[model samples]
Target chain A: MTEFLQQLLNGLSLGAIYALIALGYTMVYGVLRFINFAHSDVFMVGAFIGYYLGHHVPESTVWGGLLVLTAAMIGCALLGMLIERLVYRPLRSAPTLNVLITAIGVSLLLEYTGQLVFGAAPRTFPPIFPSANFHLGPLTISSNQLLVISVTLILLFALRFIVMRTKIGTAMRAVSLNPRAASLVGINNDFVISFTFALGSAMAAAGGILYALNYPSIDPLMGVMPGLKAFVAAILGGIGNIPGAALGGLLLGTVETFVGGSEWSTYKDAIAFAILIVILLFRPAGLLGKFTVEKV
Target chain B: MDWPLTQMLTVKNLEVCYGAISALGDVSFSIAAGRIVTLIGANGAGKTTALRTISGLLRAKSGHINFNGEDLTRLPPHQIVARGICHVPEGRMIFSNLSVDENLAMGAYLQRDKARIAQNRDYVFSIFPRLKERLTQAAGTLSGGEQQMLAIGRALMGDPKLLMLDEPSLGIAPKLISTIFEKIVEINRNHGLTILLVEQNARLALEISHEAYVLETGRVVLHGPSPELRTNPELKAAYLGG
Candidate 1:
């Protein structure tokens, strides 16, 4: 039971990071109806930003950690908006296939550019939070695990409030539903799309910070595997459904962690893809996505 | 092009095309302030296209759309809406995922004045009491008639000077059709709003409109005061039942 509980705690912490990255994929898909392949690079950039801040700040307090997280989020949010304006905005009215190709191109551009600038060497992540572990009845939990879970919960609640209770969030939902109709009622859809990118990228940045804390290694290519896994999580939850993305992330994290701990750990990555294929075969719209017939 | 002083909206020699196929050609019309003008035609007669062009959804290939003294043909849809032209589109394009209240809030998105937005909300509620009852409900779950009402109510939240409705009567129950039309009249009368109405139901459209235009294959075939068009033998045979 203790071993089981230990695995559960670890899985939940990993899942929290996956949920944050998944949110970016799901939100971009929600409003734009296309996968932003460059989003994972944004996650990597967030980690780098957090690393730089950690080296400069020289404090291991909760407040210092929060300050680093905020800086990274803001930096990533700006980067996301810049990407949308430069690459995506021009192709907003283009065909879906054209946009999809452009997204893949953007992904490559970011990856290569990151390689040139950040170098190919993986750097150790600076510890921004105090090192502590708490033992509860035969199971031990690290402070980093508690931090990941708590930050994820707080960010999710903040996200909920922004999406459900705010005006811009309401406009975002409207634009997602019917952009032309939204425009007729005075909503600037381009502006809303830009905002969506900013918000989603910020979440990804928080994920990056939490990920660096847990993994202790950061590199230009760090975003690749996590990005793919989070994408799978988004698809598992329902691509455009926010809550579904969160649920899917947690579930995927738990499953992956369990598989990695077993003798067949070499097949951990294979399991996610296998589950994805099975889900697609049975429920193409995803666990929470409602299948809609296009009205002619 | 110089529009008449009384005209709230004027389309002069407007042309719109979808690639090579012409959707509208030299479609010209004018709406007087506070008057309900109806565009009646068969399917593909370009009634919806004309409205879409005026609201800046479709860019005009060549023409001038003069709305409230500004040239609207060149502006984007959101700018057109910001200039007090609100379109209640066909198929009742209410944001189904959003709650009725949120849908209404989106209508007044550009309006920063809290008090006026609140007042406009009250006005919309008064016009469609059913909308107020389901304010918190997702718009998609509402009945078709209720969705139509929410669409109109949502438009009204923008506090438009010229309200353009595209096929508001299509697919509605006969009982609610009259009620909807009556409410359209009431909105025009009470709000003193200039209305540009497009409808497939020619007889009913002519019955309530101050002026009417009949469109055929992207051209204005016939136009006059509603009562005059109502009595025209050719129009009566083609549009109203023989």
Candidate 2:
């Protein structure tokens, strides 16, 4: 029972990271109805931003850690907005297939460009926050795990307040519901779309910094595996549903962690894909997604 | 016939196309301030297209749209809306996922003045008390008539100088249609708001409007005072089901 509790705690902390990244996918999907394939690369960029900024800030302090996270988030937010303006905006009225192909291209571009600039060798991520281990009965919980979970909770609440209570957030929802109608009501759809990109990218950046705090190893391609898992999480939660993404991330992370702790640890990665197939077959619209018939 | 009112909107030689298919061909019309003008036509006759182009949802391929002495031919939809022209589109495109209150708040998206927005909210509630009653309800759950009322009420919250309504009578219960039309008249008369109404119900459109334009296959076939167009034998046969 103690071991089970330990694994569950670890699973939830990892799940918190996935939830942060999944939010970006879900939010972009909500407003633009397309998967931003380059989002994972943006995550990698966030880690590198932190790596560079880590050199300047005092390590092992709360304020220093937050500063790195904020800088990474802001950098990635601007990058996300730039991507939308330069690439996606031109393809706004084009076919979905064209956009999908373009997204894959952008992802590859970011990956190879990252390799060129940052080098393909992996580097150790500097400790940004103070670390400690706590023993509760027979369970051991690391301070980094606690930080990940607490930060995710706070960010989630902030996101909820922005989306549910703020004017721009309401406009975002309106644009998602009906773009033409939103425009008729004096909403600049372009500005709203750009804002969605910035918001999602910022969350992904936060996820990147949090993930590095636990793993300590960073590389240009580090985001690919976690990015894929978070994409699955977003799909599991229903791509355009906000709370659904968080639920899906937690559920996926818990399941994957349990599988890793078992005898079939070698097959842990396969488990996520298998679950995706099962979900696609049984509930293609996702766990919380509403099935909607296209209007003619 | 038009002695007092100033020209509020003018469209000259406006042509709009979808790919190669022309939706509006040489459509020209003018609306006077503080008066209701109706464009009555068949489904394919470009009435909705005219309203859409005027509100800058669709760009005109050639020609000009001048609103209150300023050119609005190339402006985007949001900018046109900011310039005090609000469009209540067909099918009553309310954001169904949002509450009735949120929908009304969205209509005031461009307004910065708190007191003015509050006043507009009150005015909307007074015009459609049913909307006020369902303020927190999801807009999609409202009845067809109630949804139409919300659409009009939402547009009114924008504090528009010219209100363009497309098919306010469509898909609504017969009993509630008259009530909605009465509210439209009441809004125009009480507020002196200029209106450009497009409707498939020619009889009802003619009854409520002061001036009427008859459209057929993307061209204006006739234009006259509402009473004169109401009595025209050709218009009656084509549109009034005579």
Candidate 3:
């Protein structure tokens, strides 16, 4: 029972990270109607940025981590917006293939740029807080894991509220529904697209910060695996649904934890791809996702 | 009416192209305040294209679009929507994933008046009571007629002064068509809303419109009062079921 409970915490914490990263993929896909292949790179940059902030700033000051996290999130958000405006926006009229290829190009740029600046090797990510462990009943959990799960839950709820209740959220949905109709109603599609990228990147930045604490490692290439895994989570939850991404992430994490808890740790990565294939075959829209038929 | 007749919306020599294929060519038209102006055409004619251009979905290859005295040729879609020109696009582009109610709420995306939005939703429900019954249902599950109602209802959420509807009567039962068209008239009369309608349903559009523009192969070949155009020999032969 205790072992199962421990795995549950670990799964949820890991799931939280995947959910945030998955959101970036889902949000961009929702608005642009294309696979943002570069989204993984954004997640990678998040970890690197968090690593720098966590390490460069002294560990004693609480404000420093907060400031650094905030700054990194803002920086990554700006990076996302810049990539969209400069790279994706120009190809608005271009074919889907072109956009997909451009995304790959952007991914390469982010990856190589990180390698050049941060060096080729992975760096050990410093802990954000003291190594404190808590045992409740049979389940033993770390403060870091609790912190990750709580923060992830809070951010997810906040995002859901913004998307469902706010004016900006309506605009995003409206633009995605019918760009022309939205515009005729006097909506600026460009603005919505820009917001999509910014919001996605910011989420990725938060994910990066949280992920570093949980994983205790960072590098330019770090985002690649997590990004791909999050993509799986996003697809599993439903590609365009916001809540679906989080749900998918949690499910993915739980599956991995259970698998890794046993002797299947070596096949942890394979588990993600296998689950994704099964989900796609059966429920292509993901567990919480819905099917949207386009207006002809 | 004033010389410009307090023009609520105006488009001059609006040209739109799909890459090498030109969809609308030098398409100049305008709408007065509180009038139903219909643009009637064939399947490939420029009616939808013109609406898309005005809405900023398709950039005009050339020409000017001014709404309420502001040049809108350069602005994007949402900004245009923000300026109160709501478009209920062809094929009813309601968000299929969203709930019927949520889809309606999204129409009022630009407005900050929460009270008014609720009021408008209530009024729209009154106008299309079927929607009220299916508020929680996903929009994709709706019937054809219901989808049409949801599309127009969603547009109403925006509190638009000028509503641009493309192919409102397409792909629905004839019984529902009259009711939908009648509701459009009631909306215009009660709300004093200006409307720009585009349709391939020549007879129906001609019947409902105060004035009409007939397009053929990307150009307005004929224009007149609806009743007069109803009898226009060429329009009858070309578009109306002669």
Candidate 4:
């Protein structure tokens, strides 16, 4: 039972990060109906930006740590906005394939540019949280892990509140449901679309920063696995379904931890892929998504 | 034909093409406030195309559109909508993925008044009691007649002075078609709205419209108040299905 408890905590921590990054993928897809492949790179950039900012801060003061966190998020928000204006905006009226190809180009640009600035070598992130672990009888969890989990929970709830109760949230939902109708109803499609990218990408960056604290590893390419994994998680939870992404992430993480290194560990990656394919084949609209039919 | 009356919406020398083929050519029309006007034509008459261009969904290669004394020729779709021109595009284009309630809420996208939105929601539900019954149901799951009602209800939620509808009766049953047309007349009478409706059913459109424009190959060939245009010899046989 102690072993099981330990695995559960580890999986939940990992899942929090996955769920955060996956949100960027899911929200963008929900509104824009585009993959926003550059999203993962944004996550990668967030990590480096956070590391760079956090390093320069005089962490002796509470304000400095807060400043570093804010600056990283703000910087990533700007990066997301720029990508939307330059890369995705032009392809707005183009074919879906053209938009997708442009996404790939933007992704490569960010990754390569990051490689130049941060280098290809992986660096250890300094401890953002105190190196202290909490013991619950036989179960143990690090402060970083607790912080990541709590922050993830707060963010997920905040997102839900925004989407359900706020004006911008309603507009985003409206735009996602029908762009043309949304426009006809007098919502600025452009503003909402850009905001969607910024909000989602910023959350992704937060996830990246938090994950770096837990693992202490930071690299230009670090975002790729988490990005891809989060995407898989999003798809598993039913892409475009916000709550589903979170649930899927936690499930995937728990399943991976308990099952990793076992004889079935080889099936971890395969399992995520297989579940997505099977779910899509039967319920292509996703677990929480409703089917849409085009009218003439 | 000069459109000397103060034009609420003016489209002059409008041209719309769909990649090499001219779907609409040199179309021109004007709509005044507090009027019920309609464009009636054959299946390929470019009736819907004209409405689409006016709403800024399709670009006009050569034309000037003035709405509420403002130039809308080059404005984007959302901007035009923001200017209080609500469009209900062809074939009841309801957001199938959204719930009926959510769909209604979206129609007030530009509105700022929280109280007014609540009032407007109540107003729409009152207009179509059937929609009120299916408030939580996904729009796609609604029956054909209910979907059409939801489409119109959604458009009305915007509370625009000028409402444009395209083929609201396309897929509805014959009884529901009459009911919809009756509702249109009631809405106009009660709300005092100006309407620009497009339809292939010449008989029905002309019967309900205050003034009628008979469009052929994108040009308004015959037009006048409904009483005169309804009895016009050429329009009656060619378009009124005499």
Question: What is the alpha-carbon lDDT of model 1 when measured against the actual structure?
Answer: 0.92
Evaluate candidate 2 by giving its C-alpha RMSD to the native, one decimal. 1.9
DockQ of each: 0.92, 0.91, 0.51, 0.62
RMSD of 3: 3.1
Docking class of predicted structure 4: medium
| lDDT ranking, best first | 2, 1, 3, 4
Candidate 3 residue-wise lDDT, B81-117, digit = tens = 8788888888887777678877886777677888998
Query: lDDT of candidate 4 vs native?
Result: 0.82
Candidate 2 stretches with Cα past 4 Å from truth are B1-5
Q: What is the C-alpha RMSD of each candidate to the true structure, in Å?
A: 1.2, 1.9, 3.1, 2.6
Give the runs in model 4 whose Cα sits over 4 Å from its true position: A56-67, A263-296, B1-5, B114-122
Report the number of the highest-lDDT candidate: 2
Reference-based TM-score, model 1: 0.98
Query: In model 4, what is the error at residue A112, expressed in angstroms?
Result: 1.4
Residues A1-296 of candidate 1 have per-residue lDDT tens digits of: 78788988899899989999999999999899999988998999999999889988866788889999999999999999999999999998899889889988888888888889988899999989887999998999999999999999999999888888999888888888888898999988999999999999999999999999999899898999999989989999889889989988898898888788888889987985787779878989888888987564
lDDT of 2 by residue, A223-272 (tens): 99889999999999898999989988888898899899999989997986
Error of 2 at A92 (Å): 0.7
What CAPRI class is candidate 3?
medium
Q: Second chain TM-score per prediction?
A: 0.98, 0.97, 0.96, 0.96
**Model 3 / residue B65 / CA error / Å:** 3.3
Q: Rate the local accuracy (lDDT) of all candidates.
A: 0.92, 0.93, 0.84, 0.82
lDDT of 3 by residue, A255-275 (tens): 888888888788977875797
**Model 2 clash pairs?**
none
